[model samples]
Target: MQDKSKEAAILRSWHKNVEPWTRAVRESEIRSRVAVSDAAIVNAIIAQSPKHVLDLGCGEGWLVRALADLGVTAEGVDAVAGLIDRAQQRGGTFSVMSYEEFAAGAWQQAVDCVVCNFSLLGHQLVEDVLAAIATLINEKGRCVIQTLHPAYSGEPYCDGWREGSWQGFSEDFSDPAPWYFRTLATWLAMFKGCGLQLEELIEPLNAESGSPASIIFVLSGSSRK
Candidate 1:
């Protein structure tokens, strides 16, 4: 287990830096080619028709807004108060809380779906987060994570910890938290150890570049051994 205090600190600093950068790119970020693949993730969640949903590290509440637009009860939580405040101002349901804090609480009402989008990176506590995700969902519930594809990310076939920064965007972005890169196999193993089963792994590719911009993992607890 990671030291909760230390994990919380890292989360806070990273998100504090990210809040403004994300705000600058809102809505426009979704139109990027890489973001087009996110549509697949959204489609998968909608197909599940979840009654209630939890979005971990939910930045700016775009996913929540989309889900609510479909009549699904959705709530978002982020460590950055700036992002949470903005989300509320935009008429989205949001809370200012880190994943560690959010996961430590008792969610008596387990949700049908939990989404962790691109925020579960560079942390040794990812396994712990996965365990927490298990407790957040009900039986037959699913957890979906959309993140950088291990194969095509950074160096080909590299599996190790590396500090990451905002890139492929404008010079305006800065100070990203570090990332612990893992191969697809490593990710699957972590899921299994956390008492979850990897149901599917989808890589969203860039049409022009012929490279995957991100990967989405669909996981389930019932399938765990």
Candidate 2:
């Protein structure tokens, strides 16, 4: 399938599985998340010492809530209305906005940090969105992204589409969307193209397997220290 088609399927899958997704997150059903990735991403963000933060592709606003507890002013945005509704119900600033809309400059608010936690799953639009985010941060800002390590893709070690799955998830979840997998090199290149520099590359380990649970890219504007 085409990149755009796969991207569309991703959004559709999210829209269709909002309930189960929310339940899974709230209950901490995902083992990797419960074991490593969640705190990994959160700690990565806190290390940035951001005054204001934006959680792009923020699902049910869990990160926002977590950051708020630490006294950070954080706002969230997601494309799925159902997810946004659930997020708002829990109380925080969240809007239903697609990455395309964000790339088009829908939200005017700028922040010291921007985060994408396993939410970036597109191609051209992903590049465009990063470009847009580049302009929406302060000079001393950072953009942190945590995603599945490319080395664990179990496919050819190159950039391409891979079938997504709800394999470890409950039976209630369905409509898994195919995601565009990017190698570490591609990820670094994309960041550079967006005028961002890699400040750190973190591989959070999964205790059970002693393997990396996810890879976190800590990036900042070229001028940022």
Candidate 3:
């Protein structure tokens, strides 16, 4: 029941704060380092030419739309109803459902790839979510996850160069979401525990000032023994 309340709060927050800024932010970032990282992720999977792909926590379906434009059959899921409505209105097949509610067998025996862009970190039960993603992937399938750098996660930073104290905000400000700010080592271990092998790690140039920015992980699932 506590988890349910948390999830509900997250969904409400998304509707109130995050969904309103989704399109503009995504469009602007798409032309910046964020887009470069996204392209790198797509490139890694292009070699396999996956037939079915799932975009978890897909907001406004930007990445899903991009994948579809590239001719990949993609479906998206998000917990926020407003985001899902917008995504579907844009001709995308998206559902307002949490990863917890997703059925592995409903999609297929397995999915070729699962792309989680700036999502899934906030859940209190992150391990369960990761495990669910592992089950959703086909053997040797790919999983791409992108998240903000640790320095920005719950770190005190001055927003303005003028004289002012650095105010603190939650790391997962995007959705009023709850996040466990794991270090790089912790993230790697989480994936490994879910039976995924790290294939590539790309750090994007900071969109704010071109310094080293966010981290993206491209992982491949291991065959069941």
* Number of the top-ranking candidate, with TM-score as the measure: 2
Tell how far residue 154 is off in model 1, in angstroms.
Answer: 2.4
Q: List the residue pairs that clash in candidate 2.
A: none
Q: Per-residue CA lDDT of candidate 2, range 149-180, in tens?
A: 99975768988888989999999999898888
Q: lDDT tens digits, residues 48-117, model 1? A: 6788898888777778988888899999887777777777887977887765565576444589999888
lDDT of 3 by residue, 1-225 (tens): 655666555566677655444655555634443546567556655655788888888888877888889999888888777788888878878887765665333444478888877676543456667777777777768788877665544454422111111123333334444444666677788888877778878776755677545677877875543
Q: Pick out the ten consecutive residues of candidate 2 with the lowest summed lDDT.
A: 152-161
Query: In order, what lDDT does every prediction score?
Result: 0.74, 0.92, 0.67
* After superposition, candidate 1 runs with Cα above 4 Å error: 1-13, 27-35, 223-225
Off by over 4 Å in 3: 1-8, 25-40, 44-48, 103-109, 151-175, 207-210
Candidate 2 residues lying further than 4 Å off, grouped into runs, are: none
What is residue 166's positional error in candidate 2, in angstroms? 0.6
